[model samples]
Target: MRIQTILALTDFSSPAEQALERAALLAAHHQARLQLLYIAERQEAKFCDPQARLEQRARQLSRRHQLTVQALPAAGDALAALHAAAAQADLLVMDNRLHGRWRWPTRALGLLARMLRTSPCPVLVVQGAARAPYVHVLVHAAGDEDSGGRLLHGAAAMHAGATVELFHVARPRRGLGLACGEAFARALRSRRQRVQQLAQPLQSVPHTRLRVSDAFETRRNRVGLATRGLDPARQLLVQQQGTRADLLVLAHAPRGVLRDLLQAGKAWRLLAGPEPVGCDVLLMPQRGPVTARPEAAGDAPARQSAVARRWTQAT
Candidate 1:
């Protein structure tokens, strides 16, 4: 959860520029190295010098933010290049509007989802303008206790002084047949209790004590819990809108075939919906076994194994 390096993906669009600005602010805040990656298509490369442009921008950002910045130029497939570049990065920052102008929202969401699934680091999908440092962060907590703790810790680490609220939605069991008001109330109470128990460990830990790194010495972020009815995606949106949170954090776990058939992914639904959530989103992958990085044969396993251990401990 300690961010020492951030990779910002850009196509030189307005949205991409905004995302880059946000990334710069974060890099400055964390005192981390910022890498600007510009992937040029074949046709674009044939006409313009992308490497020069990227270097110029990197210089501007470095001067503005007073941080180390590197310009990375690549040609061909954007996704493949990003995956490769992100292997050593702690976080990937990118605009929600990616690629082709027409039907770009859908395409961008699809691309974002893919990046979230595959990226070795957390992906920050910039939606709103980065006016200032994050103030209030809304985090979605599912049934997984460990994931919730990690999300809380990560959120606290990333935005040190921001207030974080852990939001959970409980759905009643179908076969319970709790048609009676009292029975339904009991079920709701039970679910809420379970969620509270899951979050107790996180809440009990003092936020100021969380020491991811020197740059991330978090203030006492007032952690609170919220439970609501079904339709998780909609409820999350509503909760964010109501609280006016500047950032939303979600765990990007793989969906089963049954879950996909039954409902759209929550992250996809929120990002791709007609009404935007009006907040930046940080997607943390619920990783399983670590994938071997494309590194030297001797060094790759040791490095990847260490990374796996860190992630395991973090969760």
Candidate 2:
């Protein structure tokens, strides 16, 4: 939630520039240090001086945003360099079109999925321009309870003025044969109740001002659920578009399930699919059972207690 250092990866393209602008805006708002990293293609680097350009841009951003900005040196492997740099950062910001295209290569998608899975901090994928501050933040709360709470806290902390809404999509049980109409109705009711139960704990997190919504509600109601036959990923996308959210937050899938999600599941579609969502996306890495060191000092205990209170309040 507390961001002290942000790393923005750039290739000097338009999307990257927009991402940098957004990152600078966040840096200014949070009083955080902003580090600019220019990733150049091997052939392009041979023809131009990347470091000089990177430093020049960093200086311009520093003067413009009135914040500390540093240009990181280029490395041989882009993914390796990014992973190494992200290790020390509190947040990582990058454009969706890092390769100068929206439809990414298989290898690139694999590397990105790996980074999201292993990054020490949250990753922000900028899909749109930074015209203004985010007004609506939609967080996917269908994963681990702890992960969902952490994401909600982070989103609330980062965009304090924005309205944060938590939503869950109840996917129909798989491999089950068709049921009678009455049985199907009962199943639907059960799923809706389960989603409500899952979201109940998040409503009481001490520091977060979250608006929890039932995705299964009718179309006439607020935040209506997606059509019944769609997968959870498509359902989430539909809900995000319906709510007109400026930002969408999701926790990284767990290790055992991560590979499938990245390769052909929801994460893949949202992150690297042909169709792009209207809002920016933030992906939080899954934390382990043991507590890791806090990104910011002096707030670790308070943050932990806040999460603890969420669980305690649920019971």
Best by lDDT: 2
lDDT of each: 0.65, 0.67
Error of 2 at 151 (Å): 1.3
Which regions of candidate 1 deviate over 4 angstroms? 40-47, 76-78, 98-110, 174-229, 255-263, 288-315
- The CA root-mean-square deviation of candidate 2, after full C-alpha superposition on the true structure, stands at 10.9
All predictions: root-mean-square deviation over Cα?
13.7, 10.9
The TM-scores of all predictions, comma-separated, are: 0.70, 0.72
Candidate 2 vs. true structure, TM-score = 0.72
Q: Which lDDT tens digits does candidate 1 get at residues 120-209?
A: 788899986777988887877553354446777677766666777766542233232111223223333645665555455445544522
Model 1 clash number = 0
Query: Could you tell me which 10 consecutive residues in candidate 2 have the lowest summed lDDT?
Result: 174-183
